[model samples]
Target: MSNTQKINSTITHASINKCAIPYIRYKLVKKPPEKYIKSLQLDLFSQFVTNDKSEVSNTVEIWESIPKYFLTPAQVKKLRTDTGHADPYEWNYSEKGGNFTVRIQPALIKQGNNKYQAFFPGITEELVEEALKKILTIQNHGIHDVNKVETWVRFSLRMVLKELASRGRDRNINQIKHAIEVMSSCVITLSKEKKEIWKGSILQDLVTVGREEYLADTDAQHIGRLPLFISHAINQLEYRQFNYDRLMSCDEQLTRLIYKKLINRYRHANLINNYHFMYSDLKSTGLLQQNREIDNRKKVLSALNELKEKNIIANYETDERKESRAITDVKYIIYPSNEFISEQKAANKRNSDSDKHSIDPNLISVNKS
Candidate 1:
């Protein structure tokens, strides 16, 4: 069948608002907002309902291929102590492999800034960021327009709390607010081979306006914005979709990170069932911070067990290398669950269907002929 026929068949099987098709086509090519808004009004005035819920529990890839350690999984108190008396909580980390070097410097705030004190984004901040990304994907805004620094979203603390709740994280309004502050305040400078790639906070220009009591309410709404770079990445389609439900199911920070790493690797490998990684290499991902080898080994084992219990992975085997009767290194062979593989396959098919259907609104008539 023709691409158009295939798309139409799929759309017919799944009831999609016909009026929204024009908007979707326009959005696929990154049309101007005013133009798309006009199209929406003219094309989808009556019987128009956005199917935003279809995006729930899916994430749009935002973070680049930087080391996972960019955002430490360490506890907040330990992170604070490790940074010492340095104002703005600055620290430098470097990793070298083969011919390239990655250098990262993360600070709570830009140098010489005394207004806001932020720390390295821990699990809480990471969760908050993921929630925001989910919101961005659902709303389908900000990402298409990279030139506008003012591209922002207005959402309620209640809305954020609800998203967090879906991930099995029960955080209060105060904690959510703090996570936003940290994300907005923290500045990260990442470079490869001495060439700066990224330099800014995860979020910027956050403006929240609501009374404490009102904001505390479940229905209260507020606003936050993403950085321009993030928007650009989303515009470039440099994102990944993951099952948020499974990610949040892993209770420990390392487990969640490991799950993410595995998913990325598996996807890259075309959904292969088996994959292996050196234990020391995994430790370097910043997911493992325990000082002693035994402690780190225990943490890794526990995380793997949690993944198994959650059915994210079918099973895993570890190989320990010993030098002079002392453990020198470890390796892991991971087997992904059948369910996880099926989920990924379904997601890929959905994306493929969407792509097949995405013809420019202007060209739809010609293509139909």
Candidate 2:
């Protein structure tokens, strides 16, 4: 169509299909041998940035430059009447007042590390603080651009693949082939460079680390493979590539099938409590009936267990068998270490002397010692 198209066409569709596509493919790349391409339901070109208005105009120029030699102008005349070929060429870019808006989702543009101080370690903490103030604000609220929302996520995905490819090729040209062998997926097509640059599937490979589950299902779309969410899918397939309101029904006999060995090897020695137990106590303070004492025992025990797991209490004695309530160890001792003890004693002595010094001095000092 144009230089851009011609240049992009140089990209191996097979490669893109293998890696980045499965992670973002709209559909049509799934296959066997465990490698298939899938689209992540993104409009890749919509978010493409242009240098200026001239560049957008240049796209049409690129399309106009198609040679008339092997691909003669007659082909275009014939394609005008063709159905399948026309569909691929007909793109609606002018719908939004001359330019397609590309806005990335707030959650999608998230960097690998939200609060990380490393990797970008060379950057100063003060600078990091300011950058984060702005970055996190938009990240939480979503970016405001139509095309950005539409295409930025896929663009990020594209960046990931490109980076991976650049890394491998710079090191060993031969490694390119091996890399392709491993990354060659039938699902989606990507350039060899795209596969090599994209270290792993973006949603799964993890451009950087994050605290929560990286590929959450909120924006995920299904392509076959259960909920083949971004949780992870290999580019192994690129180019070569719920629930409903259930009707009420009677319960049926079900079979218990065990794929692996049955019994639990690790017995439930104990059920240690977590901080949530204490939080529950505070939270349920007013949420219960007048018979509070009835539930107090259970609540206290739950909190005690939680504190114990956290190593807040140190004396580890065996649980004594109990019959009648003999005032079970309700008291817990959290002893300070030697330094802490010394500091505390010093502080106490200082306070005691200060109190003594406060007594009226003139009344007792007249002996002239």
Instruction: Find the candidate with the highest TM-score and give its number.
Output: 1
lDDT of each: 0.53, 0.20
Residue 265, candidate 1: how far off, in angstroms?
Answer: 1.5
Q: For residues 1-369, write the lDDT of model 1, one tens digit per residue.
A: 000100111121012212111211111112224332212111211111123333334433324333423445344445454433233333333333521233332334432445433356667877787677666544433223333322354566777888888767878887887677667665655443443434555665555555565545756544455644344333332234566667877788778777777765676333455888777776656666667889999998999999999888898898999999999899988888887776666556544543443354531221211
Error of 2 at 329 (Å): 7.2
For model 1, the superposed segments whose C-alpha errors exceed 4 Å read: 1-118, 140-143, 146-151, 210-220, 268-272, 354-369
Clash pairs, candidate 1, are 61-239, 61-240, 156-221
TM-score of 2: 0.15
Could you tell me the lDDT of residue 77 within candidate 1? 45
- Which one wins on lDDT? 1
Q: lDDT for model 1, please.
A: 0.53
Cα deviation at 267, candidate 1, in Å, is 2.2
Give the alpha carbon lDDT tens digit for every residue of 239-342 in model 2. 10000000001010000000000001111112242111122222222222225543644444443343344332222222323349653323222222233233
Scored by lDDT, model 2 comes in at 0.20
